[model samples]
Target: MRKLLGIIFLLYGYPAFAQADTTQYRVAGRKNLPENYGRPYVILISADGFRYDYATKYNAVNLLKLSAGGVASKGMIPSYPSNTFPNHYTLVTGMYPSTHGLVDNSFYDPHRDATYNMGNKAMVNDSSWYGGLPLWGLAEKNGLVSASLFWVASESRVAGIPPTYHYKYHNEFSNDRKVEIVKEWLQLPEAERPHLITLYFPEVDSQGHYYGPDARETEAAVHQVDEAIGKLVAEVSKLGLPDVNFVFVSDHGMLLSDVDHPIPVPELVSNRKFVVINSYSLVRIHALNPEQVRPVYRQLKKERNKDYKVYLTRHFPKRLHFRTNADDRIGDILLVPRAPKVFGSNPPSKRKYPGAHGYDPKKVPEMKATFMAWGPAFKPGKVIGTFENIHVYPLVAKILDLPVTHLIDGRSKVLGKTLKSP
Candidate 1:
């Protein structure tokens, strides 16, 4: 009963996300090559919050055996502020969150004078809020068809295009159905088939958020996702499609944070002087006026301690890739709290759940993501060390033979070695 309720919490927890548009959407008349069946197939799978060690720790038999036959990474690194929306977008766009304009899961955009929150359906589907060319859009632009069962910005018309086949975000969609849909996509007639497909899973992340990463619920969630992936692979393999490949990854990992004695709402700076978008994992402070920036910065800095660190936009660690070469979307002041100590509600009531993420993965090694690939395209039984998630974009592009027209932070060389030589 506890596990069942946890599943419900992850899948149906958000009343706002449960919507009427659960049906699959298609873009009619989008044609690919004359001989599309010959094109390489890449099914990109993301199991959100699947920590680097969970597969081994939880004994995810199918995934371990599958990855063992192919290439597995020691771990995959997420871009700074290891949140979901930003890192997922980065994985597809080959750009850092700051560079890509999703600086955080929730942020203030001064130019637009609006905030982009992951939960706000209007902001989520609004193409203006997103930046960078997602892989589906990349494939579509290059005359190859693409599909997304679910992904950040997939519902949005990113890069002025959505995938040929896609679906709006919803939690009720079952894992079995998603794999069936992917199979149906590949089973399509040649010209109408999607060579590149993206699928996302939220079960693991959900359980991790509600029950700490090591809890039985989380372990059950991991095993469930593992079984689903196993089913997906087995079903797809029966089709005997040529040159088919599978790349499994996660947006970021999970961590256990102290729910008691949480970081309260910023009381030092006047609320009127600044706008605070506190997601608990981190906080973004937006100043109402440029003149008020330093005054607020100083106030927060003086109070900063082991609990959290405050950085003005200009001073965010260069390695974070957040401060430099950024769009105005990044907050005027960034507040990053350390592990087991997350930003919290006023009066500091104990949080309902102990599990959390969005910490700097470098500092919290558990926040590091996972990466593995198997198929005709990957080098068998190889293992590579940690590499940034940004490079995943270029690797997928190279697999589908799509051309990247714009500049991106991800370089093919970072992950090019894992692929079989052309």
Candidate 2:
């Protein structure tokens, strides 16, 4: 009986247990806050593609100091397809890619009959493609000011409200410039200052893609970002805001890819009519004709070997927590390559860069990202085990004392362990 109850709780979160306080942590409801509520200031920072090991391996002085003084996790596992936009959106919305409607960095949306690409400014700014209310939107609705420095989907208005302040994403911006912008937002007057802010730095991910995860260029990039973080921390400390919190996270980590071992997609699918969306390690196949589904599935299944795993969306593994919705926007079939390997239509050039991600997070340790919290609200000098990235949303919501507006998959108890007692 005890074992069965444990399984139930694991599947349904604390709500499944009779003794749990469902009212305080209700997953869906309107929450009203007092006109002058006292909420801690929170700053969420994302260092894109900074792997779990990079925190210690690359001599990142700022991250190391933060980890030592506050709560740090072994790693933060990203949602399946473990790409940038999907996982970053998952962090803020507490929903999987299927639930949030940003299934990939780039994907075709059948409902809108449009293609949403990360690089296309107009499509990125379109609010129709976004499904869940992001953290900034939730904060704004609850009367708290929020600002964003290039978080995915932050530029778009959700529920008819954008962040109180946000900047258009520009990759050319230096890490120091991004940090300076966050500092400026923090320097506003008490009434005008944002209670929640998000900052992103993409240098590490860029270097990792161009020079592999272990290369000296990646290490240099990590150090550069770390210096910027140190400067930001100093600026925030100067403000001396009481009960300020900092949550450092990453979208997903990178894996060392071998240019020599490319799994050709043509070998797995003989049919030429399918639309293949390939992201190196993960491949999504959408059949143009309904008749081609079975044959495509059969061909891919037969080709599955030590190098890759294939699954029909309906039969996707339960552990991934993906393909939950009927109109998930995923392809008819999904292909995930084994670690250090990639799936592509053509063989990679010998000169091609040698690192990638978007593999199953459970299988690749290198693909695991970092999560660390430092603030008055968090416990000091505590190190916890790995957790899913979705849980970050509820943690932030709890700190800001706002009610979640939708039914999200994240569990408060999973992340509540990192916080100090109220």
**How many clashes in each structure?**
1, 0
lDDT of 1 at 164: 90
What's the lDDT for residue 318 in model 1?
A: 88
Among these predictions, the greatest TM-score belongs to 1
The digit string of per-residue lDDT tens for model 1 on 147-215 reads 999999999897689999999887666788888999999898888989999999988888888888989
What is the lDDT for 118 in model 2? 76
- Residue 329 local lDDT, model 2: 71
lDDT of 2 by residue, 257-308 (tens): 8767687776545455766777777777777677888987887677657787
lDDT of 2: 0.79
Error of 2 at 178 (Å): 2.1
Local distance difference test, each candidate: 0.85, 0.79
Our model 2 lands, by Cα RMSD against the true structure, at 11.8
